[model samples]
Target: MSTIADVARLASVAKATASRALSGKGYVSEETRERVVSAARTIGYVVSPNAASLVTGRTKSVGVIIPYISRWFFAEVLESIEQALLEQGYDMTLYNLPSASPERDRVFEYFLARKRFDGVISVGVELSDDEVDHLHRLRRPLVGIGGAIRGVHTIAIDDVATARLATEHLLSLGHRDILHIGGNQDEQMDFAVHSKRLSGFLAAMHAADLPTNDAFYACELTVPGGYEMGRSVLGDPRRRPTAIFAASDEIAIGLIVAARELGILVPSELSVIGIDGHPYAEMFRLTTLEQHPRRQGRLAVMSLLANLDIPTPEDASESTVLATNLVMRSSTSAPRAPLHHA
Candidate 1:
């Protein structure tokens, strides 16, 4: 019912001037801009993003590529990123990227090549060199979370150091028979986070002159996966560990549940520590290293928005590694007795 032409006529300015004022693109006097804006409000006129982008070369939207949406860490990251973008007057388009499949290929070859959004924020998906080059070809800003990417700004925590700290905490409490329960090294997730964490645990164990034989147990990175593994591992009295360093909070919670079911008193019979500050951690009184995923998400959005208009050098990629905080709880303590092998 209303148009820019009508607003310009009512405000006594040229149509181009009205457009520039509304879009905030070209220089327009404050008095003229206020007059045009008042006229637009009076006429119920709204600027069309499609038309505005034609002149400003910005969609005011960001594309997010993530591997999983249901997982706790990923879900938190996505929510924080969406909120941060909205606060900056930007929209979000989410792409749920699946593991190596035909659909995944199409997402890279077709969907991404379209350049529908102003930039991309990749979460927990390590893009290959070809994929990075493809996005670079469009000259759009790119940011990543969960791990580093070549030629891209990334936000992440030091996985190795965090895991080592968790393990060392148990060792400080006189836990010699410790086990690391985490994702499989062979079926590594994006950036080999599973392997990195396991490596840290092993490194800590070795540093203390402790034997690492049969030290790792591979399982899915979820609560249920941990429950099942915990059931079997804790069921065997001969092979039970004095302490466990879970790769995630969910796994640690599951293990605690399983240990309770088997009449094993936590901290008295077994100790457990994990990464992630999952909401349930406090309820379970589990010791953990909180790697604030939501903070990473917000920082990722900040990095992308700040660099959207700047030209980044090809070799100037920077990785911002955040620190993890250690949370002490009732789940970990000194072993009740000396560790004995069956």
Candidate 2:
């Protein structure tokens, strides 16, 4: 029920002075600011975010656009972003953009146009030039995670190189009959992550002079997707690969589960390696390349905040690539014997 006017009266200051003191905008003497804040606390007065935004040209809120919420990577990234924003005294509004939905257009053309957020962090959602231009026209600071968009600030790991390293790990362990269980290239979202990862696998195989025929299998980028593909591929001992380089940790976990159900011993009969250091990776004892999505998410927020502070069009758009580390575990080992093919 208390208002800024009441607080101003209680503090014996003009409403404008009270506004300046509370918002930390314009010039207000430190003594006067303390008095105004004391009065506001006494009266339980709260500044209207809308009014403050009008005065400071900032909502103190951010919009996060993401493709999948249920997946491990996206969920971890989102949790990190939310925690970082909260610590920075900001709010997050999430927009889940499912594939093949008109909601993406509505979010860009309507919701974002409302100026409810001061900035945006897009996770794995590629933007068209027009979309990027629209956000730029509104002067909303934008940061992308997972892939690059032309003319947009981005934070991502080297997808191709990471994949190459994962494959190379398997190769170094003397894995000749290797298979890649990765995302479906044709069904990939805007970023073409599936294609990039597959390219990395192929690049490593070619570099090592390994066989490439029938080496790639397309699946959803989830545990269940990997489980299904693993069942089909690892069912027959004669056709089983010596090792599998899964595109993600979730997929690798799924394959491990499937292999267990099929009575196939891992590392002894088949080896598995994956990307991401998912929480369950250690339990599964899966060797992996850890990209640390949570850290990437937090860094994305930091990048957006930095850009907001010094928003020069030229300086705001920079691409940052993070690194990945190889984690050794029980799931990967050299084949027991040379694989023979008829």
Candidate 3:
């Protein structure tokens, strides 16, 4: 096995220069790099990873920490991140953090301490001060998606604003008796996205002087969650909110199903709106606020590459905020007078 030392001796270059030249990771003069490459090729020198890490201090891998992989948005984000990382010639190691505090702590204390990746992308995993500091002290660059970090790069839609937009759109169509089918109030995800979205709903309702309190129905962020909640909330014809602003398209789809099963009609009887451009959203013809999680994942990778290209400053972090727009569809309209108060 030809070692770097053998390449250095054959090329008559210093070991350090030979390492840099062979790896193409750091700065090396063109002539020197070519000579080193030639010598490496001649000797069939394959750089040892352990040996290379001892010199360049990089694992050439990325750590992606996420909360929910089974959910639509999270899955889409992961796929986009995977594709982007592959194109950049990098490897991604995923860390699926279960919603448990002790397990979450173990990820930071034990798993992160292993130091296998060059950097990290916390996909919807909010980092605590200690966790952030631990990674920072490890000299790892981090970028957060789906939430905001106190002192690191982040990219996400304004969850509150987007929710408000959805609500107001329903209100604009004169649907005042609106319900919000959303995530649990005890969501342990990094960003309190569920809470933020609910906030938007409340803010919009308050702004329009519409009824909002107790109108919120909490559920997990899944079709089943929505379906279960819809059955409970919409089961009673006397008290169902005329329109609903579901947290995600999955929830909206479930709402539609629940409504139909209960012999209630859509648009003519109840209006529905949701966030996330879920694939089933189109199939269900749901009106939604289209924030593409997959595209957001791609953009997050782009941002990471951008920061990786330049020299990352120790004390400074680069942040980028993406944009979201409302996508109107046939899921919503003014409630009929029978379902609305005049």
Better of 1 and 3 by lDDT: 1
Candidate 1 lDDT by residue in tens digits, 1-342: 999999999999999999999999899999999999999999999998899899888889999999999999999999999999999889998999988789988887888778578899999999988888888887768999988899988999999999999999999998899999999888999999999999999999999999999989988978898899999999999999999999999999999999999999998999999999999999999999999988999999998988876767766779999999999999999999767899
| Tens-place lDDT digits, model 2, residues 1-342 | 999999999999999999999999999999999999999999899999889889988889999999889888899999999999999989999999865568778888899988578899999898888788888887788999988887778988898999999999999999889999998887876688889899999999999998899999998888999999999999988889989999999999999999999999998989999999999999999999999999999999998999888775733457889999999999999888856899
Error of 2 at 112 (Å): 1.2
Best-to-worst TM-score order: 1, 2, 3
Residue range with the least summed lDDT across 10 consecutive positions in model 2: 310-319
**How far in Å is the alpha carbon of 253 misplaced in model 1?**
0.6
User: In terms of lDDT, which candidate is stronger, 2 or 3?
Assistant: 2
> Which of the numbered candidates is closest to the native, going by highest lDDT?
1
- Full-model lDDT, candidate 3: 0.83
lDDT of 2: 0.91
Q: Give per-residue lDDT, candidate 2, residue 211.
A: 84
Give model 3's TM-score versus the native structure: 0.83
Each prediction's total of clashing residue pairs, residues at least 3 apart in sequence or on different chains, is 0, 0, 1
lDDT (Cα, 0-100) at 6 in candidate 2: 100
Show pairs that collide, candidate 1.
Answer: none
